[model samples]
Target: MAITSANQLELLQTAEAVAREKMIDPGLVIEAMEESLARAAKSRYGAEMDIRVSIDRKTGRATFSRVRTVVEDEELENYQSELTVAQAKQYLDNPSIGDTIVDEVPPVELGRIAAQSAKQVILQKVREAERERQYEEFKDRAGTIINGQVKREEYGNIIVDIGRGEAVLRRNEKIGRESYRPNDRIRVYIKDVRREPRGPQIFLSRTAPEFMAELFKMEVPEIYDGIIEIKAVARDPGSRAKIAVISYDSSIDPVGACVGMRGSRVQAVVNELQGEKIDIIPWNEDQPTFLVNALQPAEVSKVVLDEEAERIEVVVPDDQLSLAIGRRGQNVRLASQLTGLDIDIMTEAQESERRQKEFAERTTLFMEALDLDEFFAQLLVSEGFSNLEEVAYVELDELLVIDGVDEDTANELQARARDFIEAVNKQALDKARELGVEDSLVEFDGLTPQMILALAEDGVKTLEDFATCADWELAGGWTTVDGQRVKDDGVLEKFDMGLEEAQNLVMTARVQLGWVDPSELEADVEDEAPETSEEEEA
Candidate 1:
């Protein structure tokens, strides 16, 4: 074993310490040294020459050997040459056809170059190993809050030194109202971890939604314990945020607990977020009610849902509209994101006018379809009977009992009621057939072709048969049809009917024509037409 110099010995120990501290395999460092030595050997010698080197870890001693190729002649100058059989036999008992001679080189000749090469290899390998170590150490911590020292500020970005590594806090990630100074200890949520050529890159954020969530976890015990669940959160960090909270236990007031006594709990989070206002609302299962609550500090008079449009129109007092909409519409914007609804805030007067227009349209439709008198039509409207089903399904005697309804008028109303039902039912059947809703029509037996034709004429031509046939829906409400009338004599009847058994004959004809199954009739109950007075008939 050869003794190493004190300076060389210190270098070896320092390399070992770095390897140990970084958890790098000492063997990997030696392997890197061997590879580097091989490269240096090639650089020193021509391509035809081969060199092998080995390092002893205990003594830091290295040995070098040179190998030469055997050739027929000494044609190459300044080169190790081949040996003839006679000359090779002098050195060995037997020499083969293809063989190489090994020569040991003096350590002094290669020592200076080998030491320099080995040092470079060890330094490069240590950097790579340290980078890999740092990447693995921080990759697991992505999306967690880490305490870091503000290292420096560059172009509005704050660079944070997170102990093991440094992270970039982009301008967008900083709370606008908060200022960070060098050496300031702060907690930032890790937004992402990325691997770069230099080392692991950590991206941190203070404005992220999770930043607020983490603050809540630290400040509120209920949140940490999972008793209060944050259903959704929306924010304009450093300004305001809206969070929806729900409690598993009925006894817990989620918002109250989150708010804390004297606003201690939420205020801690607010302070951390640079005094951002948080509106913690109780989550409700009913969407309209929930939306109304989400738009807090503003009273809502009503919430009208337009499901087809995927929007909600909230009616508030004129004075509260701006409050409901918030500054630059932030309140309603966050509310919409939290509730997954498009919110439109409307003043009370605007909503009232819209309601009046809708009511007027419904009233006009009901009167035209039922052929009812203006007085009765208005009466129906006032009673919330805006459509035909409410009018047609109302018991005839019950309607007669209402004010201004006499026996004769009641009888006439009943006849008209039967005609209206038949017409509406026929339209439904036609619509069902047109919509390929034969199976659904089978559910309601006694539907005839004439009835179906009547319905088709009334613009009902699909199995989704009804006044409103939309996406498998059967809108069975009264809608107006032309050429329908109530006779003045109080006998509800259709003109130009020569057939005596027309009433019973209509079903028989439908059955014979195979338009409807006989089984359908059995399943269907027959609707009797009101009897006509002989005096009125004359």
Candidate 2:
């Protein structure tokens, strides 16, 4: 094919048609055509020549040119593409060493092989443009729902034709036992859109928790209008799910709005999810109260929460144990996910047994440590005195409230408790020193002798070592691994050290060692402090 007057406009017509089909910009196709023509021109006009081609966007006229650059005599390497300033005097009044001289050249006629190569180049460029267009179109659409048709099945995965591009619904992303044939309409959540070597990979999902929340937003007018918000969602997918919702307006009920007048809205969502049952609970700011709501259909006797550990214990009647835990522990698992806490469900009988065991253990410790009889130890335990430290430091009035205990008896109890604690502390300090613990760490405030011994045993023997430790390292914390929370033990965790206390103690040690400026610490604290409004301040 030859670039002549006969088909000059045909080039642009072809570009427009291809761009329309690919849903890409027509300018990109025209740019691809120019490069293909230039490549073919170079093959005929000598490969070493600087051949360039430009197509007029309006008239679609192709112009070919050969460019040569003026270089210094010593730097000129290619004679066909380079010219010296002295050699360029004939064509110009003055030419600099970096100036270019362009000469109009006749366009090359495309032979059979050259035309085929040019077509391939245009096709490759068009494909790249199409991929880029797809990526740009769907990048921001992630975390949204889209309706598409099943194109085909690759192994167990579903390839969906999502308007401008194809998306992949992985086998694991589908609801349990979900099967689809070609041309089946499906609604999916746009889980992710990633740019790869082949193209933009749009991954779709039918089992995401966000999918249910979005469905409610689509069905409930209140949710769409921002009167209600979906706080959390946990789904078992194709089985059962739970959603916590909150309403901004006191007159509007979030749960009722989602449920509809007679369960129309929730039923619609249930049909889409293949009959998965859903429990819509009202959201509460208090975690324990929220957890009680999350574990529905079961009566809870009491709730115990450990804020630092992100764990909770729920006591239910023995008959409701199976209901609270659900079949295969699904109810508790979903509740845990919704509340972001690890839940331990026990019957009321079990809780009482555990309490009795703890009481017995505390009573025995007091009896052995303070040289008291069983009855006296039990009485102290019954009075809510759990440990020697509380007994040693408690005021006389507190002990005086106990039956058969006067001021003299209270004084005697404190002396015995203090003496026992001092002996234990001295033993621990001596053990820590035997383990090569430095005096700098031993004299550090806020750490007990037992804490020092624990740190010494863990190879943290110096103040520098303690200062270098992370807050989580001093106070045990939970880590999420493989979608499950795992506990990380801390050396000082046994002393009930919280992360804030650990951070403060570490900062104090750093200040004492001159590793950190106290002024900077104070500035950081001030920066973190919340500002009060003028009205509140007044």
Best by TM-score: 2
Q: For candidate 1, list the clashing residue pairs, or say none.
A: 427-455, 431-461, 431-462, 431-463, 432-462, 432-463, 435-462
Residue-level lDDT of model 2, residues 86-195, one tens digit each, is: 99887779999889999999988999999999899999999998888888999999999999999999989999999998999999999999999999999999999989
lDDT of each: 0.70, 0.93
- Candidate 2 achieves a global lDDT of 0.93
- 130 in model 2: Cα distance from truth in Å? 2.0
Residue-by-residue lDDT tens digits, candidate 1, 258-313:
99999999999888787899999999999998998899989999998866435688
CA RMSD, predictions in order: 18.2, 2.7
> Which pairs of residues have clashing backbones in candidate 2?
none
Stretches off by above 4 angstroms in model 1 are 1-11, 20-35, 45-57, 61-124, 198-200, 306-310, 358-538
Question: How many residue pairs clash per model?
Answer: 7, 0
